[model samples]
Target chain A: MARPMGSVRLKKTNPATLAVGVALCIFIIYFLIGPSTSDFSASRKATAAAHHLSPPTSPFRKPTGDKQKPPPVAHYNLNNVTTTPNPLENRENILLLTPMARFYQEYWDNILRLEYPHELITLGFILPRTKEGNDATRELQKRIALTQNQGPEKDRFKSIIILREDIDPPLTSQDEKERHKMENQKARRAAMAKARNSLLYSTLGPATSWILWLDADVVETPPTIIQDLASHDQAITVPNCFQRYWNEEKNEMDERPYDFNNWQDSPTALDLAKKMDPDDILLEGYAEMATFRTLMAYMSRENGRLHEEMPLDGVGGAALLVKADVHRDGAMFPPFAFYNLIETEGFAKMSKRLGWQPVGLPNYKVYHYNE
Target chain B: MARPMGSVRLKKTNPATLAVGVALCIFIIYFLIGPSTSDFSASRKATAAAHHLSPPTSPFRKPTGDKQKPPPVAHYNLNNVTTTPNPLENRENILLLTPMARFYQEYWDNILRLEYPHELITLGFILPRTKEGNDATRELQKRIALTQNQGPEKDRFKSIIILREDIDPPLTSQDEKERHKMENQKARRAAMAKARNSLLYSTLGPATSWILWLDADVVETPPTIIQDLASHDQAITVPNCFQRYWNEEKNEMDERPYDFNNWQDSPTALDLAKKMDPDDILLEGYAEMATFRTLMAYMSRENGRLHEEMPLDGVGGAALLVKADVHRDGAMFPPFAFYNLIETEGFAKMSKRLGWQPVGLPNYKVYHYNE
Candidate 1:
């Protein structure tokens, strides 16, 4: 009887179960080697509190009751020297830029929750010329319709503009040695830079005072993020990006550094950066010690001891805010290495060369999608 | 000395005083002959009551407390049979159309005061390709910007579209004989019809359920006007046109009939309508008895007794409500006579031929600007 039953069912392996087993294995492997999770401890918290001595309230804050106290004065160093009073209540015309891959419902939901006024914000997007992009746009339109029905009196965005670009050229060879081929990387970066420049020049009107580069993959951020960045009053600023990863063993989620490109330049690193051929890209993680720079994500020692305003040699596009005037003043995302960097990082270098200070917030972190 | 000075001044014949005297004489003559003011009397009031029967609360009313009673039911005659119903609560998509001539601050203020949900309405404009139209658009933009800044959270219109069309070809000749010239009238009517049709077709989306044609010069109306019209549930309906005029004798404002196009057809009128050549024009006021029809504006008999709902052979476009589906089903403003009528009158005939009922509210009035 047992033999007959086994022959009827167990004799052949179930394909679905086999596939699940393979998937589980791949998932585990990916987490094990992909990135290091941020370690948390009591001492780190104390240090973080000590390092970030004062955090300014956003300027967009609506006045509360008379009992509400005034915000503490914030001091920001320019050129790592001269201190200036922060412009706390400045009303700026902000232009938001996003290069979308696929539409996510949560992305819009998060945007609607932003603490800033919708009337002052102009949203701009660039979608890839792919079926996915078209589907995303359709989904977004339905979302807008739903929003319209729910609140007939809600204010709409000041303006909305959508653009499309073709996919970047693919690499010709898969060989590991040829994978880092300069031509392929340059082609990909160039396409990205071109797409970004087109969006900026076409949509940034005279009224716009600031330009925010937000990647679609960045799914979660505090609603006060925009106001917080504006409060810093820097020429350029970026927030640290963290990716949330599930710790299967711990039965909880953990955070890992997603973008470690924002860093402070050292003499050796500056030399190495300068030595690179104009066309050569200085890879982030690979050229770490050779470039004599330490990433902001790694530099915060003793828990929260990271400096409040760290000089950034390069900026991550996942979330970067810049003065619109800087862009109008000739700063652009260089596809080929200018100062041994390209794309967003290259843009930061270009801005610096124009005598604009770029700052990074080591303690302020925005989450990126795991994918 | 005073007498001598006065004589010298009077002899000089001041040019400004002469011009003022001439303008006053012209104004007096125009007022005396232009249009007759509606006469008032107790008998007329009784007759108006009898003709109207009942009036209902407008749908545009915002709810108050339990003590606030429902609006009185309105009495309407369909095929000459009386019926009463309260149509105070119905929600549907409405497209507001206006052919603007010049910018008026009061006009925008009145629109903003409309009781309907802004998100449910699409505001569309067709401006003449002239300096006045351009100036109006610029002023409108500034007004919108001001409104946005004052109330950032207010619900904005679902969408706004402003289009420009070359002013219908100016009349070729101003000769009084040529002014009523058939070709000139046809050309002017055709131009207006084309402008209206272009605005309607280009902007009306599938989601739109109704079209409200309101002339920009017709400045003021009850906030609940949209709801009032929708409540009728007729294929086509119009509000009585009242021009607000300053009464020099009374030193107060008075109202008079501005549109008398809505009429009941008589055999003689039908015969007259049939006899007209296709190319011949039916001048609004001039075609009176030739068409054997009684204008509803005059048929009201007494001051207030304008029938609430009247059977009409034609209607005016000052303020017209039409079903979107009717337009989709092929009703249009024919520049040429289809039933010995052109422009809005022709539109009524076209809709009737398509098995739709056209009705008018003679008692309900909306005001027009003096200009």
Candidate 2:
């Protein structure tokens, strides 16, 4: 400092200057290590919603006098689920959904097909709709109620009999650019809603603790898969997909493994709206899996909840299992008003909201045939 | 004819025809009841040179010129050996060849690459060629001699030794199109011949009861490979080779086992000529393996050796072990004016003269590099 040494001066400091410098250093450290060090912002969700949410529009369309009738659906949230834990605990509940098609043969040909660990998988069946004509045919409606009235097996875990009357007719999106990109998502959602509706309005409805869905094409389902799943409380998915790669294609019948890359990519509403044609459908859309772990990840800021999204592009629907309470608290799968692509996507949405994660095990695969 | 009933007439058979017919009836019964089944054809030698071979016509040929210049090798037949069995025979006197190679480092980075009933597998060294360059150049002649001298670890059960000089090499060929297909054949033969020559002339000149030629690339070369070979007093090849059309380009690595299809188009020659280049050079072109059991197959019609030639292409040398007497009795590698093409072919030629049949092992696949 004596010779004004070109900004590299070593000078004696006063008490005030020293104090100021220390304060500045502390500020710099705080600024550098702040954001990544904590999840305080994410944790304070209540305040963010208040400040972030957009204003809602006019409810009931401003009480139009022309409203002589109410909406046909009496339920609010459409998912309407009963939230109550069953009094009978430790029953080792199991849920199996038997869609109308191919159910009889599947039951005779399958069901106790092989051995499994004791008390691991309990079976349940859900009767699918016979017809989805305009206002839901009476005969089909009668079948839904009759099947629900039949009740569950003696050893069955499904105390809550889910009745499914409303079914979406098959409609192929003809978007040449968008393929089966969104099949898993849309199908899963609709299926989930149908299952929830039936379960919610059953005699032993509240007693039900678990629900399982199986694909109709499955020829031989391995029992050990369920046993392994039951071993862990963590949300999981048994590996159920396979692909044909450049090298793996050469594998003999005995050498084949489940492939993943060949999954159907479900599209989103925005993309579908542009061009809704099956031929135009592109196989690039995706959906999230209905899993407790995944839901938790989505709720939290970390876990990379937005990663590759396994099982989302297309949930097999061939097999799925879920807890009853999970649906009640999560509001369950909502009925789709405008589209039939709800079964797969609806379940994923509900599971995510309920804070469940999904996992796929490699040793498990479902044998099935598809046209 | 007594009556023209569909031109049928009662006629007495000629005495010769009657005998033949009786024999044929007996043969049919014997065939039907004998439980005719093929055993592990490890005893049969394939087509080798036919008998009554014409000696080389060259003016400088051995017998016509100088008998002292190491007369051309003599063929082995049952009439040449002592028929009386030696009761003193303890463990089959065996020869073991274990050669070290560059890429084979994984076998023995440590522990001497030992994997076996140690009594089997007499580990040997790779052959070395003469060097002509500077200090960087290793002398090939010196190296080959040194390698043979050092040989495999000395062991009691495997007193018989195998060296690279056992094989004969050639210089040229009459057909170029056919010659290019061999794998390092030229150099390998030269080294093999030199190895045999050096061993035969060395202090341990007399081969033990048996000699073995082991291929280095063989993995999982079970002790049984050696034990199995030793069990037979006669020469044998575990994995006898057969002409196989392996389209390396197909499926890259989905190679099926060698079978009849590939061999159907192969040449017809004495297992000897099959083993040698037409110019009498060493060539390992045949499809199968040959051992002392091989010699037994060719032992002779009167000697009780009735092994029919299966026409195998080559014999694996991974654990080749042959009786010393077989070599001592003037049995030796065929002369190769050019390069050796097939080893099994060479062994097959020697085998036929010795009345041996080369047989193939269906299940024995000595560890070999697929790449």
Candidate 3:
């Protein structure tokens, strides 16, 4: 009786023929699969190199992958991200990030008036999925379409990405009075921090050299604001945010401090932070939660000293610019209380912890819309 | 000496064992390769379905692929592409296309002032590679980023796409006198036809129900222009284009007819077309090449009739709205002369050949930029 191929006796089989068959099969499998496996591994490594350099505190870091290891040093050295004397010749890309809840035409006009080369600017916007957020998004999109589709090529932005993601419960009202209520500060600021981080991570491409966190309500920035801010060339720089409001008693428009978050931490503020609950957040510009810190807003003079810079313990989102390496080093807005601070304030603490100095321009002012 | 495995005769081999070995080898090969081939074929069919329904006249059609066969029937039936009475509630997407060489702030302002639900509008632009074109693109991009980043969500556009591709030789001067020269007419119009076609093909998504061919120079369209033109619900509709100019002689602003391309094809015009060379193009509003056709521009009265529709043989591009299926069915602007007409007029001729009627709103005015 004939035996099956698998059951053939080793003594009866020709060892030389069996060896040749096995070698041919192995060669064919390698020929068919080697290139594909190599390509797959290469792409996996590239992805890890791009996104896996997360800090210990990053919520985005993978739980199962290298969590105990320290983050790798950033590819972009902080020393190399200095400001250029002439930005017109500089080709480095700047990412303009905005967290929007309301749309204002005046704010859009100010952005359009910036004299920086639009081709080097990439815009990223994150808006909540609420009714007001949807309304703002629609208006913003219409304006974008008009400018992008009709403008000169050199003045066009490199790219614009809008993300609609809600990180907080929908607010019943966007009224300033309702928004400023002391009880809503922690939740509101934490939601905003999440939005900012979301925009940063999703839009921070490899080409980004700087990040400009300009609030959507910042309506009256100088046309040379980008050049002015970039010329400082600091690790992190923030301009004083002010608003022109009608002083009814004076019967004239008067400028007032807008963002109180740009401040120098005082001994009293540190003591208050220590006494607060672990989950409690510290907020600026409120009488009930007075930190009594020296504010950049209060340091403004009549004529505005353009080159004046001061080291800050906390920063404001309004017209703040930072080198990309600072972010790549794993500094982001904290959505939860970190040392009794959250959001933009927490971001300053995190940046300092990562060895980046946050500086404030006391007299370089960007105006917020007075509504 | 032992014989090799291949040299073993059929009588010496076990037929059942050989059959089992052959079947196992075939199954392994199929297991490794079957899914990939099926996926590849599916994607290829999808691509062919999306792009292969081109007419015989399309210059974009592949020369070697099924040239003799008629184009497949369009998936979007023209009869079903009618405009809704209420666009506010309509979910249909409208693509706004423009061919730009310059950017004007007033033109951008007019687009922003439009009262349509911005979320339903997608803007598309094509520009030349010339210096002026670059300048226009830059300025336009600045405006787009501002609006898109700051506007209310409900008022924003669905999307915006800008394509920078030059089809014509760069013009040394953009002066009206230099541009209007009869010698430059054919090349200029042919290049424009190519730009228009490029923008249309690149931006026409499957969801686009309507296409509004708005010129970048048309600076005074009504806020409800989209709703107004869409209410007509025709396959193709064009509003009369007029320019408001300072009448030094009359000492006031006077409205003058701008687009002369919207006209009824007279017998004299057909005779003129027959005598012209195959590559020659027919231009409107010039006394030198008068075709003696009745123009839609001349049909306007002192008070201006808003709802008056006039059937026409040729159409102007300024504020022209068309159903998307008319374009999908192969009606594109001809870069070459078709009936001695090129660009917008050739598009009208092509539309008629494809059985879509071209209609002009005699007094529904869309003002062109005076400059």
Candidate 4:
């Protein structure tokens, strides 16, 4: 009778304990699985915010937190994604990054004319905190809002971000002669490098498959510029940047080579770099700082050979395309001299250092604004 | 007999279920509390690395991860910290930030002469990737390693960081004439702004209470320079920067104003800024780009009036002291034109915009190296 009574008491408490255990297990599982799924979505949204758009507040706000750690190095598992011959069908996302000091209406118009799927292209711009930059920012925001909110879905960019540069540009003069002075090249390029890095680091996201560095002054290109560049599938590719001007004598638009940065280093150039002061930057297209290198702009012929590609030792920022992995693998415009080069040329050196080839399309022309 | 057997079965299962429950509870609690504590420590270490040292691997490597999020905004709970009149007894941590394109042994020696508590000082340097910068970096590292690892404990700084600028400088010439050229001022200042920002952003940590922007060429100051500057507890402060040159005519050392950037904006300057082109930058010390402002460097007297503070509209980078909160509040050297100004002057403008008063000690002198 005592044993039975003890067992009966045990039986009474067993149901309550079992019920609590079942409830606890369900709660634990829900918490374990639930947050991860939510976290995935939350992170996706954050990536979009980081790379594509800025909140309405201030774009220049420093990311906060005393315990904030540097982000983990990014790795893209491209093994799983099948590569198709046609980039259009591959559905790769391209981030178009531009560092704009002055606004050009023609540049914005040219961007709208690109044949790439607007839904797949994310646009990013880093502007100076100048009156000109302010005006440009306002105009750009207005245009983006109108197109993104009011225009047809097909015409809209997937996302857009406008960042006001945190640092002031040393020289704000847009005068072409002042800009092209060999004396000012080092400073100009260094500032440009900072702008590019700021834009790239701030906006490059996990979804970005490729990065397109388009200058604000690049006003003309083939409507299929994106497809043409992406189809090459190279680590880095740049089209010859040229400018068309009304010739007073001919009365017709005359084409001239503009971006001299795209070039293959001659022995003379390499020798120059070797002998030059580590701080002395070797600039292209200057008589004073001569590096007898072949220019891609001059390589173009009258007839179309748009697909003609040549291996390049250096590249210009104007209308350049790069794979996201190359950047992830550590290639950026050096604000400081790299191998006696800075900015785009420095980036080329950095890319080569990382075992990535930089190639140029000699006959593939992109027209720069006639300053 | 049936009921007794059922009771006996319940008794046998009771211990097993209870044991399982106990084990599950223990596992859950361990996971819940364990990771958070470890995360705290790991994050602390990450902060140290991010702010004080770069790993042996490339410092330029981009922080990885597709799910990377910008750090949360840092909030310093200073309400609990008591404010003492004497900065020496305040136990405040000061971060000395310097942007160097060239290394001067005198500057390093002067830093060592500072009377601030070595254990509370964290030093940071950002050098360009130029040959000059390389030499400077190597020498700086050698000096730092010797002092940090081999020197007496009291002589050792709390921590030190050395960073190579990511972008190439636009101008690398150390020639005083070339550097001070009015045409190159914008570009030079812009590049300097970028370097300063890069160093500030990369090395600033939660532990920092104040920031001292000491230029590499500023080779002389009072031994208690840090204490004198920090004691003011102003949002922003700058000492008069002057230079001593061999006076061939006087047969003695002659003093002259070095940093014209430290000034009180005159009505003429403000009017000029208002009338100037949006992108046009107003530079100091240049006759061509003249703004008739009252310079702090010219206000210093022969005798000891070292604590005379005056309101200022602009401040130079040579030897500026600022509360960390002023920086954390978003006052940075604008690389772009801010009210027709850039770099250090632009920083003063930005600080004012953020509601922080910028003050100058006209009688407080810090000697700049004569170029």
Instruction: For each candidate, report its DockQ versus the true two-chain complex.
Output: 0.01, 0.00, 0.01, 0.02
lDDT of 1 by residue, A1-371 (tens): 01121121122111111100000000000000000111111011211100010111111122245553322212221111111122224445567887665677767877777666554555666655456655765676566545432332232443344544434332232443343333544555545665566456435432345777877767788887777786787888888877678978899998766665687776866777667664577655442234546676654444663337788888878788886645643456654455677777878876775557889988778777664
Q: What is the TM-score of each candidate against the true structure?
A: 0.39, 0.26, 0.41, 0.44
> Which regions of candidate 2 are displaced past 4 Å?
A1-371, B1-89, B98-103, B106-123, B130-191, B196-207, B240-319, B337-344
Candidate 3 lDDT, A1-371, residue by residue in tens: 21121121111111111100000000000000000112221121212111111100111111244433321111111112223544556655677888777788997788788787765676767666666666877898777755554443434454465655532234455344444566766666655665666566545533356788888878899888878887887889899988788989999988877777788998878999889886788776665556778888788888867888999999978889887656643466766676678878988986785467999998898987765
Q: lDDT of model 4 at residue B175?
A: 48
Q: Judged by DockQ cut-offs, is candidate 3 incorrect, acceptable, medium or high? A: incorrect
Best by TM-score: 4
Candidates sorted by lDDT, best first: 4, 3, 1, 2
Tell me the tens digit of each residue's lDDT in model 1 across B1-371.
Answer: 01122222122211111100000000000000000011111011211111110011111122245563322221111111111122223335577877665667766777777777654565666665555556776776566545433333233443445555443233233444444434555655555665565556544432345788887767788888877877787878888877778888999987766765676667866766567764565655542334446665554434664337886778877789887645643456655454567767877876675457788888888776664
Q: Give each prediction's root-mean-square deviation over alpha carbons.
A: 27.1, 39.9, 35.2, 27.0
Question: CA shift at B299, candidate 2, in angstroms?
Answer: 24
Lowest lDDT sum, 10 consecutive residues, model 4 chain B, at B24-33
Across B1-371, the per-residue lDDT of candidate 3 in tens digits comes to 11121121111211111100000000000000000111211121112111111100111111244433321111111112224655556555677888777787887898888888665676777666556666877898777766654444444454555655532234455444454566766666655665666466545533356788988878899898888888887889899988788989999989877777789998878888879885687766566666778888778887867979999999878789998656644466766666678778988986785467998998889987764
The alpha-carbon lDDT assigned to residue B295 of candidate 2 equals 21
Give the worst 10-residue stretch by lDDT in candidate 1 chain B. B22-31
Assess candidate 3 and give its lDDT. Answer: 0.59
Q: Which has the higher TM-score value, candidate number 3 or candidate number 4?
A: 4
